[model samples]
Target: MRAAAAALAAAVALTLAACGSDGPAAPAGGSGGGVTGDVTVFAAASLTESFNRLGEEFEAANPGTTVTFNFAGSSALATQITQGAPADVFAAASPATMQTVVDAGDADGAPTVFVKNQLVIAVPRGNPRGIAALGDLSKADLKVALCAEQVPCGAAASKALAAAGVKLTPVTLEQDVKAALQKVRLGEVDAALVYRTDARAAAAEVEGVEFPESAQAVNDYPIVVLKNAPNKAAAQAFLAFVQSARGRAVLGEAGFQVP
Candidate 1:
C-alpha cells in the first residue's frame, strides 16, 4: 500500500509540472493579440492628427495598454530609429524613409503601405493672393513656403511642380509639412505646398487647392514594427490595429486614400 501511494504522488507531481509548463507562447510571429503593455510609435508629422485619434481608439480596445507617439518629419524619425531610438513601431510618409530603417536591420519585416496622400496648395481662407493653380505659386509676388527637399512633402512638391512645368522659388524652405503650412496660416507666406490631409486638418486657418499635377506625386505611407522593440507583442498589436477597417475609416476621414 505504501509503495502504491508513493507512485501516485509521483504521478501527481509530474502532472503539476506539466501543467506549469503550459503557459502561452510568445505571440505568434510577434503579431500581438493577447498583449498588454506600452506601445511607442514613431510616425511622420503628417500623421499626427490621425495617429493620435487611432492611438486613443487602440488604447480603448486594449485595456491596460497605452499608446505613445513621437511625431516628426519622416526623415528625421527614420534617422532617430536607425540610431536606436526606443520605438516599437515606425510609420513613414514615404517608402524611402522607411527604407532607412529596414536598411539598418531594425525593422522586423517588410513595411506595409497603409495610405496615400497628395499635395495641395494651402492658401489663406479667402484665396487672398488669387492663387488658382500650381503655376500660380511661381508668381514673383506670391510669398510661398515649401518643405525642404529632404522631406517627403518637399520631394512630392518637386515632382508635382516638374510635372506641371512650373518652376517655383519658395520664400521659405521649412523642414516639415506642418511648418510650411504654418507659414501660410500665420500670414508669413501667401501660400504653401502641403498635404491635402494637412490642409484639411487646418481648415479653420487654411484652404486646400487641389491642382491636377498633384496626382503625379501621390505619396504612399508605410508602417512597420521594429525588430528591437521592447514591447514586440504590443507593437504587433498596434500595427494590426492600424491596418484594420476601423483604422482605414479614421484615415479616410482625415483625407487619406486607404491602401
Candidate 2:
C-alpha cells in the first residue's frame, strides 16, 4: 500500500512540475516583452542623425537587441520595401511616399505622423551668396543644388518656389536631400533647398536660411511597420520606442517638430 502511495505522489509531483513549466516565459526586457534580435529600419535621409541616436538608445534599453538603419530618399525606400526588401520598419519624409507602401499592402497598419519639417535653404557657412529668399535661387549666377523632383525635399522646394512665384534652374539635381546639402557644404553649389532638420543637424557646416515660402510646403513625417517584417515583435517595439518621450526629445534636438 505504501508503494502504491509513493507512486501516486511521484505522478502528482511530475504533473505539477509540467504545469509550472507551461506558464509563459518572462520577457527579456521587463514587461515590454522579449524584444531581442535585430530590427532593420528603412528611413528618409533627413532622419539619419535622429534615428541613429534613437537606435543606439533602443539597443541599450534592450541589451540583446540591435537596430540597423537604411537612410535614403523616402520614395526610393518605399519602392524597395514594396519590392520585398527585408525591412522591419519604415519612416517616410512625406505622406505620399508612405501611401505607396500602404497601397502596395506592405504596411502593417495606418502610419502615424511622428514629426513635421519645413524646407530651408542650406548654404555654405556665412551665407556667401547672400541668399535671402526663394526668389534668390532663380539668379543664374548663383549656383543651386536641388533634390530630384521625385524626392520629398525637391517636391517641397518646388512648391515653395511656386508659392513664391519663382522659377529656379538648379545647377545640379541630387537624388537625396543629404546629397543636395552636401553640394552646398562642399562649395559645389551656392545653396540647396533641404529640410530644416538637415540644416540644423549640419549647423557647423551649413547655414539654414528660413524663407517665408517655406511655411507653404511643410512635410509631415510618418512611420509604420512592414507587414512581412522578419521580426514583428522587435519592429513593433521599436516603433513604440520612436513615439516615446525620449524619442521625441532626440528628434526635437535635430529640429524636427513633433507631431
Candidate 3:
C-alpha cells in the first residue's frame, strides 16, 4: 500500500508539472492583437486636417492608445526622420520624399500609396484678383505665394506651371503648403498655390481654383512604418486604420483622392 501510494503521488506531481508547462508562451516584441501605447506619426502639412481627424478616431477605437502627429513639409519631415527623429510612422506628400527615408533604411518596409493630391490656386473669399488660371499668376501685379522648391507642393506647382507654360515669380516661397495658403487667408498675398484639400479645409477664408494643368502634377501620398518604431504593433495598427474603409471616407470628405 505504501509503494502504491508513493507511485500515485509521483504521477500526480508529473501531471501537475505537465499542466503548468502547457500555459501560453511569452509574446515576441510585444506584437499581437492587443495594440497599446503611443503612436507617433510624422506627416505632411497637407494631411494636417485629415490626419488630425483620423488620429482622433483611432484613439477612440483603441483605448489606452494615443496618437501624436508632427505635421510639416514632406521634405522637412523626411530629413527629420533620417536625422533620427523618434517617429513610429511617416506619411509623405510625395514618393520622392518617402524615398529619402527608404534610402536611409529608416523605413521598415516598402511604403504604400495612401492617397493623391493636386495643386490649386487658393484665393481670397471674394475673387478680388479675378485670378482664373495658372497664367493669371504670372501677372506682375498679383503677389502670389508658393511653397519652396524643395517641398512637394512646390515641386507640383513647378510641374503644373511648366505644363501650363506659365513662368511665375512668386512674392514669397513658404516652407509648407499651409504657410502658402495662410498668406492668402491673411490677405498678405493675393493668391497661393496649395493642395486642393488644404484649400478646402480653409474654405471659409479662401476659395480653390482648379486648373487643367493640375492633372500633370498630381502627388501620390505614401506612408510607412519606421524601422526603429518604438511601438511597432501600434504603428502598424494605425497604418491599417489609415488605409481602412473608415479612413477612406474621412480622407474623401477632406477633398483627398483616396486610393
TM-score of each: 0.87, 0.87, 0.87
Clashing pairs in 3: none
Best of the candidates, lDDT = 3
| Candidate 2 similarity to native, TM-score | 0.87
RMSD of 2: 10.7
lDDT for each candidate structure: 0.87, 0.87, 0.88
In angstroms, give how far residue 233 of model 2 lies from its true place.
Answer: 0.5
**Per-residue alpha-carbon lDDT of model 3 for 152-223, expressed as tens digits?**
999999999999999988999999999999999899999999999999999999999989999999999999
For every candidate in turn, the CA RMSD to the true structure comes to 10.9, 10.7, 12.3
The runs of at least 3 residues in candidate 1 whose Cα sits more than 4 Å from the true structure, single-residue gaps closed, are 1-32
lDDT (Cα) of model 3: 0.88
